[model samples]
Each structure stands twice: as C-alpha cells, then as structure tokens.
Target: MKLHIVPARTGFQWVKLGAKTFFRQPLAMGGLFFMFMAAVSVLSLIPLLGTLISLALVPAATLGLMAASREAEQGRFPMPTLLVTAFRSGPANTRSILVLGAMYAAALMLVFGVGALLAPDVPAIEMPEGEVSPERVRAMFNNPGLWVALVLYVPVLMAFWHAPALVHWYGVSPFKSLFFSLMACWANKGAMLLYSLGWMAVIMMAGVVMNLLAVLLGGAALLNIVLYPMVLLLAAMFHTSIWFTVRDSFVTQEDRAA
Candidate 1:
C-alpha cells in the first residue's frame, strides 16, 4: 500500500461523509457502537487482567468499527461480528493485530508513568456543602499531569491511527504497521489537525445546543439524560470517520487494480 497526502479541506469532507453515512444506517451503526462499548465494559470488569485485556483488544475493536463503517458506507447492514474482523482475518494477521494491541497498551502505560512522574502533586480540594467550587474544577483542569498525558498521547495516536487497517488490508506486520501509520499521519498532519479541530468544533456545537435545551427544559438532570446518548452518537460518528481517513490516505494494490 502507498500513503497519499490529502488536502486539509478533505478533513471537513470526512466529517461530512461520516455524519451522512451514519444517518443512512443510524440504528445499525449506533447499535454496533453500543455493542462495542458493552463488550469493552464487560471485559474491563474482570480481575487484574481485565484492564490489560481490554486495552489489548483496542486495536481489534477499532478495526471492527472501521469495517462496520465501510459496510455501512456501502449500504450494507453491519453485523456485531464485524467487531471480530481483526481476530478472524487469519492466524498471521490476528497475531499481528494482537501484537499491535500489546504495543499500544505498553506505550500508553509508559506515557502515563512518565507523565505521572513529571506532574506536580495536586492539593486536596475541600468540598464544603457537598459541592465542588469552580476553583476546584479549575484546579482539576490545571493539573499538569493531565496536560502531559494528553500531549504524550499524540504520538501514540499517530502510530496507531491506521495500523490495524494496514495490517488487515496490506498484511503489514505490527511494527511496520506502526511505522507506516506514523509516517502516513505525519505526511498528512495538516489534514489530521483540521480533522481533529473540526470534530472538536462539532462537539462544542453539540454541547452548546444541548445546554440551550437544558435551559429551556429547566434542569441539569434533563441535560444529563439527553447528553449521554448524544455523546455516544457523536463518538460513533467520529469512529466511523476513521475509515475515511484510511481510505483517503492510503492506496492499496486493489485500488490500483480497480
């Protein structure tokens, strides 16, 4: 497969395509997303190995969502089994995906560890009257560890962005997939940045609209009731867009054959 650089504007197009495609099969896409979350949640409830296993399954789960997105884009109903696409591909590919997952988990742990070591200790906040003050909230946001973690996650995101698809479609090994994924993201960083910013704007707009409704409806409880599902839907839409990023950024041999 060959990496292709996309124009920055293509990021906005990806957002549009993802939202449009999601509407075409809202129930199926949304249900699959729910199933995805359920599976992760259940796995995470296990013992000590739970978190590790869940983290290890991330690449495969991500691949499944991408596959579902592809199916939905083609006007097909995506099955829950699509979530297992990575594991079912073949022994070699499955093992590679598993390795990729392990690598991702390890990378995340390392980043978290370093961030924790570098972060200053936050003083405990006193919650008088059983309510957190705005200062407490601000202190939470001001924690350097949180910022460090977010910053460190960027490279991990770049490395894994397309690694599963690369392995699935091109039979790239786990390490090579990470390298290629990183290169592809770096080569198309402008588009990626725009894509990220576009999503943030979409989410912010959603929050604003939801907040307005909460004001009209007269409660924070109503906001919570509506916001949870909306957040899930937006998350599903974002994951759905990931497939488009791969489609536009890479050229497989079959693409040339066509």
Candidate 2:
C-alpha cells in the first residue's frame, strides 16, 4: 500500500489528513502529546528554564513530522515506541531536527524583537496618591505602537508556518528550507495567508469565549485545561497540512523510493 499524497483543495482535506494521520498511530501520537505536556509543565516550573525548553520544542516537533513522513512513506502505522526508536537511530537525523528547531527559535526571537520595538514606552502606572481612573487604562489599549505590533506580527507568524515540514520531511538544510518555505508563502500567498488568518481568528474567538467562561466559572485554569488539547490538536493539523504541501511539491520519487 503505497502512500499517495493527496491534493488539498479545501479545509476538509486538511482536517481529514490531520485526523487520519493521528488515527493511524494513536499510541505514538498520544505518547508524543504526553511527553510534550510533561516537558512543558516541568519547564514552566523552573525560572528561565522555559526559554531553554522552548528551543527543544521545534526539534521535537520536527521529529514528529519526520516520524509521520517516514510512516506515511513506508505505508506502515507503527506505535508510539517507533517515535522514540527513530530518534535513537542516528545522529544525522538528530542534527537535522535540531537545525529545524533552531530555525523556529530564530523566528520566535524575531517576532518578539519586533513586538518589543513596536511596544510603546509608557511610564509605569503610579498611585497618584489617589484612586486610578479607568480612562487611563483605556488609553493604553489605544496606543498606535500596540496596533503596529499586532499588525506586524502577522507576517512573522506566516514566515515559518511550514518550516517544520520543510526541514523534517524534505531533508533540506535550514537555509534552503527557509528559502523554499518563504517561496511557499509567496507562491501560495492567498491560501497561506487565509490559513494563518483563519487560524488566528479561531484562536481569538476561542480565547474570548474561554475568557468569558472563566469569568463566569471563577478561573482561567479550567479554560486552559480545555484549551491546551485543542491548541495541540490544531498545531498537529497545521503541521500535517504543511507536510502535505511540501511532500507534494519537493519530495522526489527517488526520496520516496528510499
């Protein structure tokens, strides 16, 4: 049973690919999720450790992408242990994963840097020896720099949108992957832009609903519990979509034969 790369024509195609990919290797996918959660939780506890842990996430994620690509190519749906086994197999793949991860880290830093630059230089709120006014808080929200930051962050988000798939599955170097991924952004600009915007919109809407629920339910923790899995699932779907795109465009017949 040769794995065929299907053309993605609509949102349903992406969703189906995502769901099918997970269903084919539930145990492995589940294990990956658990490992990711455990790592995130542990990193969150240590001061400044979160940044270090964040660096690993891209590589780990790229590892998952590689695992999926290998499984798909072989037409075999192995269990979760396969992921661990694959990682232990060689140093070359590990290096590729780390390189891909570093690309993501660089993108994250760029995004943060842009945001920092665009953020307004507002003085810290001081207790003017009297009660604070609501108008002051409202004024903060209306800052032009804040709006610019929000607008500029969109492209940064889109830049590395398919990066994991590019490095993990395509076996491209970081520089090449970055080049092609950016080409992907421009070539499929409409679909890629819409995809990012659509996801962002969904996230924003979900955040609003969750925040409202949190206010009514008495805390955001419960909302987070529900949201975390949803976010992960979406992330998986996004990565899978990127895989489909890259596989169809860049992966050669010889590579698949190997």
Candidate 3:
C-alpha cells in the first residue's frame, strides 16, 4: 500500500460515511461492536494478567472492527466471525499483530507509570453516610495523573492506529508498521485533527441531547437507561469511521500503478 494525503475536509466525510455505512447494517455492525466489547470484558476476567491481555488484544480488536466496517461498506452483512479477522489472516500477520499489541500495552503501562510519578497523590474524599456525591465522582476524573496519561497516550495511539491493517494487508514487520503508522498520522495530521474534532462534536451533541431528554423525561434514571445504548452506538459508529481513515490514508499497488 502507498500512503496518500487527504484534505482536511475528508475528515468530515469519513464521519458522515461511517455513520451512513453503520446505519446500512446497524444490527450487524452494532452486534459486532458489542461482541468485541464482550470478548474484551470476558478476557479481562481471567486474572492479574487479564487486564494486560485485554490491552494487548486492543490492536487486534480494532482491526477486526475495521474489517467489519469494510464489509458493511461493501453492502455485505458482517458476520460475528469478522471479529477475529486479525487472528485468522495468517500465522505471520497474527504474530505481527500480537507483537504490535504487546508493544502497545507496554508503552501504555510505561506512560501510566510515568504519569503516576509526575502527578501528586490525591487524598481520598470520604462522603457522609451512604451518600453518592457527583463532586466525588468528578474529583476522581480530575486527576492530573489521568491527564498526563492521556497526553502521553497520543503517540502510542498513533503508532498502533493503522499498524494492524499494515501488518495484515502488507506483511509489514511490527516495528516498521509502527513507524509507518506514526508517519502516516503525522503526515495527515490535518485530516486527523478534523476527524477527531468531528467525533468530539458528535459526542458532545449526544450528551447535550441526552441531558435534554433526561430533563423532559424526568430524571437521571432515564438518562442512565439511554446512556449505555447510546454509548455503544457511538462507539460502533466511531469504529466504522476508522476504516475510512485507513482507506483514504493508503492506496493499493493497482492505484499506484494507475
């Protein structure tokens, strides 16, 4: 595959195309996403190593979702088996993807460790007598360590973003896949930025609409009832968009020859 530069407007196109494609087979697409989450959750139940294993499976999982998206884009119903596309590609591709996953997991853990060191310890806030305060919940997320971890995560994210596809489709080595992924991201930073912002806007609008619904429908109970399903839909749509990003960012040999 050859790298291709996309205009910033292509980012918005990705979002729209993703949503449109997802709607075309909402049940199948949404089911695949849910299945992926279920698989991850089940893996997370394993033991002390469960979390690490789940993290390591992330790149593969992402690739599987993108594969599903590819199917949906082509007007085919993506089967549940598509979820394992990465592992089924071939022994070499599977090995490369696993190596990429391990690298991602390690990089993330190291970043988290450094972030923890950089952030000051947060004292626990004890609430009175069986009370659940929003302030306390918000405080947990207001940690500097979390922000630091998030900031450090960007490059790790970049490195793995397209690495799985590169490995599966091109037989690229693990290290080279990471390099190409990073360079592609840097090269297409404008499109990537707009793509990210578009998703952010979509999510923010969802939240606003959800809040309005809660107000009209009468409470947090209704909000909670709607929130989980909405989250799954949004997540599915986001994964659907990822395939477009990869598609636009790279060209096949035939396209190059043309």
Q: lDDT of all the models against the reference?
A: 0.89, 0.59, 0.90
Q: In model 1, where do residues sit more than 4 Å from their true spots? A: 126-132
lDDT computed for candidate 2: 0.59
- Candidate 2 error regions (>4 Å): 1-12, 23-31, 69-78, 81-89, 121-159, 197-240, 254-258
User: How close to the true structure is residue 225 of candidate 2, measured as C-alpha lDDT?
Assistant: 74
Task: By TM-score, rank the candidates, best first.
Answer: 1, 3, 2
Sorted on lDDT, highest at the top, how do the candidates line up?
3, 1, 2
RMSD of 3: 2.1
Question: Residue 211, candidate 1: how far off, in angstroms?
Answer: 0.3
Residue by residue across 227-254, what tens digits does model 3's lDDT show? 9999999999999999999988999989
Using TM-score as the measure, the top candidate is: 1
lDDT, candidate 2, at 31: 56
